[model samples]
Target: MAATRLWIAAAHDPAHRNGGWAFVRAGAGGETLGRAGGDRRTTRARMALAGLLAALEDLPPGEALAVVAPRPDALVLHTLLKPPAEPPAADADLRAALAKALGATTPATRTWTLAVGDPAGPTPAAFAAAWADLASDKAKAGGAFVHSIPRPNLAKVQGL
Candidate 1:
């Protein structure tokens, strides 16, 4: 059997040292086979990048991983081999990071969509909707399966 594709929606707030992530396994008709999220103890950019890279590396081969972050710098650094030495300005937006991460000519076969959302408010339904749409689109375009790895909730973080 072929490896499955994973769609990851992450809500990160560097200031609060907390974040939430949801993983979905994509299937025909944009169905989610599995889902999960939780808090990241270390909200530091480097830690976040390391955690994400570790998670992605642990996944089974052929499993395409897509991660969505409120800020794009984290995601860009995760994918680029020779990323800039300095960190992006704290205010940088997701679109800019995505554009930098995915330069021209790179086919977005198994990709991640970075959906920005408020870390202080209730989880945005729009983010979830975007994940669903992307997962469905990818499944249709690549004919690959998708699944979400289990994670923890950020809302439970103390003093959030």
Candidate 2:
């Protein structure tokens, strides 16, 4: 079997204090495939959006990668491409700009999955659970697992 490359990332909105993580996988077929996530306490909508964007941006060029989110509506993936003006006119405008940018290049057959968690105090179990939820949704969602260990506690937690 061919080796698969998967990229995972988490995002958080400092302002709202909400966030979540996402995982994207690129199979040998050159097709973007995977899911996103959204959770109640552990993962928030905004955080999930950030994680999804981070994952997509990290993907290698020309590599097929799919995104999955627990709450697809919360994340406006397209927004990352064409961000709002330097100083966005307003929150709504900024969001719209982001949406347009993210939606611009998306394929019609894109796949999405939803997961749950807390953006703030995300436990190792929560992260693992969310990853499993999204990966199981798609058969091709398999590859190297990349995760960012939060500072302070991350440094203290052994075997993370």
Candidate 3:
């Protein structure tokens, strides 16, 4: 079977040590997934990895997929796709988890694709929703929330 293609995006607030992320499968009628969270201490990179890991965890084991994320993140992820020069450090645990997630999927094949676009352009709809959730979390004095809803239902919930 062919691999499924997904578009993913994330938002982070360094000062708050929190962020949100979202993903949508390519084409119409795919489900939209999103979540927001934070640690007392965390970096942008860690949050991005956390989002990707969450997406992976949500997938069925051995499901072949081609994950795509916006540019700068794609660059960071590409660096991670390489072997570490030295022993793992701060993000080591997350990286290890990412490895395990990939392992449970397709065997021996690359899985992510990064898209290059005008950063000034409007945020991808998925990312915008993520940002809204992040803001909501901040306002509530709590961290994050998760939801998996069909595209149309998600639209209604978001009041879009």
Candidate 4:
């Protein structure tokens, strides 16, 4: 069975403490899908876990997967790689959900890497981070409907 590679990331806006989470999944054949969401007021750790949970929820039954994330999100990696003896006091629900997901998943690899290599060009992590940032902004805006206005360049854009 081919293994799917997943990259999960979270972004937090310190100004309002709003946060978002995103996951990018790439199949063996290189097809990719991404999903992102936000919480009005939350910690980065919570958002990271949420992203992992979201990704796991979307996993196909019995499919093998390998997870990758930045080192800064060690809490998330630790939770998945080596769970604590007891349930965490904070974000217990998310932790429990993650545990459940891990229990059911068939992880292809347990190796953890810190870096995402190049930051110059857009990588999966970068894309996930951008999605997370956008989601955070949307949450700060009270989940209002958003419409896009395209422009040929910086100026001459239509709609406000």
- Best by lDDT, which number? 4
**What is candidate 1's local distance difference test score?**
0.39
* TM-scores, all models, native as reference: 0.34, 0.32, 0.66, 0.73
| Residue lDDT tens for model 4, 1-160 | 6678877777788889888877677677765666778887788888888887787786655566666676656555575576568746888888767766766344543233333322224566665666667878887887522222122221221110
lDDT of 2 by residue, 31-96 (tens): 444445433223334443444554445443343333333323224443343344563343444344
N/CA/C clash count, model 4: 0
lDDT of 3 by residue, 36-120 (tens): 4444345556656766776677676566666566675565566556655773576888887887777723475435444543334
**Ranking, TM-score, top scorer first:** 4, 3, 1, 2
- Two-way TM-score contest, 1 vs 2, winner: 1
Ten contiguous residues with the weakest lDDT in model 2: 135-144
The whole-model lDDT of each prediction reads 0.39, 0.40, 0.55, 0.65
* lDDT order of candidates, top first: 4, 3, 2, 1
Point out where model 1 deviates above 4 Å.
1-5, 27-31, 44-59, 63-74, 77-160
Query: How many clashes (backbone N, Cα, C below 3 Å) per candidate?
Result: 12, 34, 0, 0
